[model samples]
Target: MALARQLFNRRMMWMLLGCLVVFGGIFGFKFFGRYMMNQFMDNMSLPPATVTTAPVEQQRWQTRLSAVGSMRAINGVNVTTQAQGEVKAIYFESGQFVDKGALLAELSALPETAQIEVLEAERRLAERDFKRISALYKKGVATLRELDQAQATQDQVLANLAVQRATISERSITAPFSGQLGIRQVDLGQNVAPGDPVVSLQQLHPIYVDFSLSEQDFSRVKEGQGVELTAAAIPGQNFSGRITAIDPSIDPANRTFLLQATLQNPERKLRPGMFADVAVKVEKFRSVLVVPRTAISFAPYGNAVFIVRPAKSALAESTNNKAVAPSAQAPQWIAVKRFVKTGEERGDLIEIIEGVREGEQVATSGLLKLRNEGGVIINNTSPLPENLNPTPDNS
Candidate 1:
């Protein structure tokens, strides 16, 4: 009985030791988790270790709108044949630069020429007979009725000659305007019918840029306004133009108006059908405040920007009564939420129409870590990260 009691006691002691070990482990894990959470809070609550800033400078701000459109030629035409006949001669080659009234091609004019010659000879004979009859009638050798009949016959022949000459001219094809010609649709000796397209011609020196704007923008857009255009075909190069025409009436379906601009394509580099990025400056405000796009937080209610004030020092010398604290309560380290009315955006900078005033420094780089009344450190000496430029990868 004594041995059994000793064994039972030993087992009870081992069970007690196991429970204590388990309890200690649970307590340790709970304490460690709390300690880690506190450390994380301390780090996050701390102001951002570093930041970059830009001075809010006063400069002229332009309110402009941009749109995408396609380029077109100012004057373009498709040359067609007016007379149906066998192509006798092609005066201009395919893709030739032709002058106004220059002969582009000709139909078989032999038959028309022969008819003109016959009519001319008959007209001459008719005139001679009419003159002789008039003289005879004056001398009383011919009757008045005979002189009248001769005069009528001469007039009829002259009219016939004129009609035949016009027919001859119609057989020859001439360029109506000076332009560059496209590929020839017909070859020499090929029979062409009336209304058949001979070639295409376009004057591309002064090209046309056509873009549409909403009715809200139409009133602001005026004739003679300058436009800047860039094409994807020739990247980095901008073509300048001026608004030459605007539709007075708005399209009910789209609430937009068509705008036509004429650009001087001196190099003939801009081609029709190329895509363009068009910008029109509608208003210019002088000495306005401007901010980076990254600084602005666009929300449904309104746009907001966070301004950063300097943090206070805590050193004995720095803790003077006049010195401010480095906390949120400190006037020196403050986060101001300003609602800004934004205008046109160019690159990464946006034009501020109202709200935020000039010379206020805003938090730009570390927006993800910012709050309404969070503390911020202005490290203006450091450059803003290149990735901070507002974009989804333009390059």
Candidate 2:
């Protein structure tokens, strides 16, 4: 009976072990199959990305140098007082346009007026005595010395009266040039001393923009070159100007030269003290090689572009250079590492000064996924990824 019971326990243990193995296999197969199917479905449903491109063309490339600069007025004058006195009245309002010699401010002139009257009375008394003396001299009744004293006294009094009139004129402030007035710092009855600024005036019809160029650039720049400017206040609006002045001497410490441009402020919209972005057209290259900035893949070694050529030729070039493949699905591309010397960049277009020839298409789009000798599909769309509209005429 003991033998039979032991055998029965062993049989039950075997049955339990078989059931556990069957259940484990079923769960493992279901989980593994589901994970693999999900990955396969994801790969199948992905869509190809759309791309844009630009055909290589020959054109005259305008070399432009861009820099940050500030706007100034053609003639900005700070109106100040020459004599110290109490402000009697304000003649002009802030932001009011005035002509040359227009009265802008007036100081106290009551004391000056009284002094002029006193000098006039003294001159009258002196003149009466001088006339009487002159009559006596003509008749030989008065000596020459007495007549001379009276004449000198009368002349002195006349000079004093003239001096008083000139002093009164100085108390009134007048515009030195035709311009719009800035803020008035003082009101009536405010005391101002000599050299105190009364109001700021600026002639803005033809504004001036001041900028600095490096000594190397200054050597290449010339007067009458076309310049462009844009202010922060006026978005999307450009102002055109010409290089009016260039400094003869280069600053030795900074190796920069000062320059000025004259811009037309028609409508008087531009004001002084505004920050401006300036661009000067230095050179106009004719029928030059140009490329989109997106085409140039910059690396520590050099800058390169992908040329869409026949698959066999691209493979031969890549095999010859031994380049790594890119891990993305862009058009089949071949990396052509050319040492190109670049010129000025304007908008999204850059002038290829050297190492590129006309009529050769460079990759403007799909640059990030390009590999050496990879097959490339040409998509000729546009060269500029940004705005391609011609710049507005701000002349």
Candidate 3:
């Protein structure tokens, strides 16, 4: 009985020891996790971290709206023939410059010319007969009906001559305006019908830019306003013009208004159908705060920015009591996350409409690692893109 009791006590003691070991392991793991978390928090609260920052600026900001547009000719048309005939002579060369009334091509009008000669002869004979009949009727030598018949015959012949002359003129092709002509579509002796295009004539001295503005911007747009344009086809070249027209009605489908501007393409660099980027200056704002786009932090709650206020030590020493803090001097830069409301954006810059004032510094780079009320050292090693208007990549 004593030996059995000893064996039972030993088994119980072994099970108790196993439970203690498990409990000790749990407590050690919990203590280690707490230590790791404390270390992480200490690192995050370091005195200063490097970041790029720029000062808030106040300037006369020019509000501009951008849109895509297309270039068109002031006067563009395809020169076509109005009558069907065999092409006789092509007087113009391919891609030639022509003036108004200049002959381009002529169809075979030989048959019409021949008929005109015959008509002329008949007209002369009828006129003579009419005059003779009129004289005879006045002397009572001819009947009044004969005089009327002769006069009617003379008028009929005159009408035939006019019709023949008009038919010949229809076979001739002429430019309707002064412009550079496109490639000729017809050759010598090539039969062409009515509505056959001979060539394309385009007046390119002054070109028109057709674009549309959103209905939200309708009230700000007006005729005679300045517009700047750039073409992706022609890089590094900018064209300037004044708004020549603004549509009186809004487009119900897209809720936009069509506008047109006239630009002088004197060098013939601008071509029809070229895509253009257009910017129209709406108005100017004075003493408005502006900041680089990099400084903005977009979030679901609201847009915020990391502003660099003076460290606790600097604030304590500052003469202005408004910047003072109750804590002791900590001699390091502080990053204060401030929620801001921004307005229009142009290129890489944005207008700060609210929640930020001029002369304050905002972190421009290294913002992804920032925390609210964190410490940041100002480092401006790299510069941000600063363009008032930027060209967009079509790709």
TM-score of each: 0.65, 0.71, 0.67
> Cα RMSD (Å) per model?
7.6, 6.6, 6.4
Report the C-alpha lDDT of model 3 over 209-254, residue by residue, as the tens digit. Answer: 9999899998898899999898888875678999999989999999
Cα lDDT, model 3, residue 140:
99
Which wins on lDDT, candidate 1 or candidate 2? Answer: 2
- Name the candidate that leads on lDDT: 3
lDDT of 2 by residue, 286-391 (tens): 6666678787777887677666654445566553654333445534544454567776565667677777777766767776765445455565554355332235
In model 3, which range of ten residues has the least summed lDDT?
A: 322-331
Identify the runs in model 1 with alpha carbons over 4 angstroms from their true place: 1-58, 284-343, 347-395
Per-structure clash totals for the candidates: 0, 7, 0
Q: Rank the candidates by lDDT, best first.
A: 3, 2, 1
- Candidate 1 vs candidate 3: the TM-score winner is 3
Model 2 residue pairs with clashes: 53-381, 53-382, 332-374, 332-375, 332-376, 333-374, 334-373
- Please give the range of 10 consecutive residues that has the lowest summed lDDT in model 1: 311-320
lDDT pick, better of 1 and 3 = 3
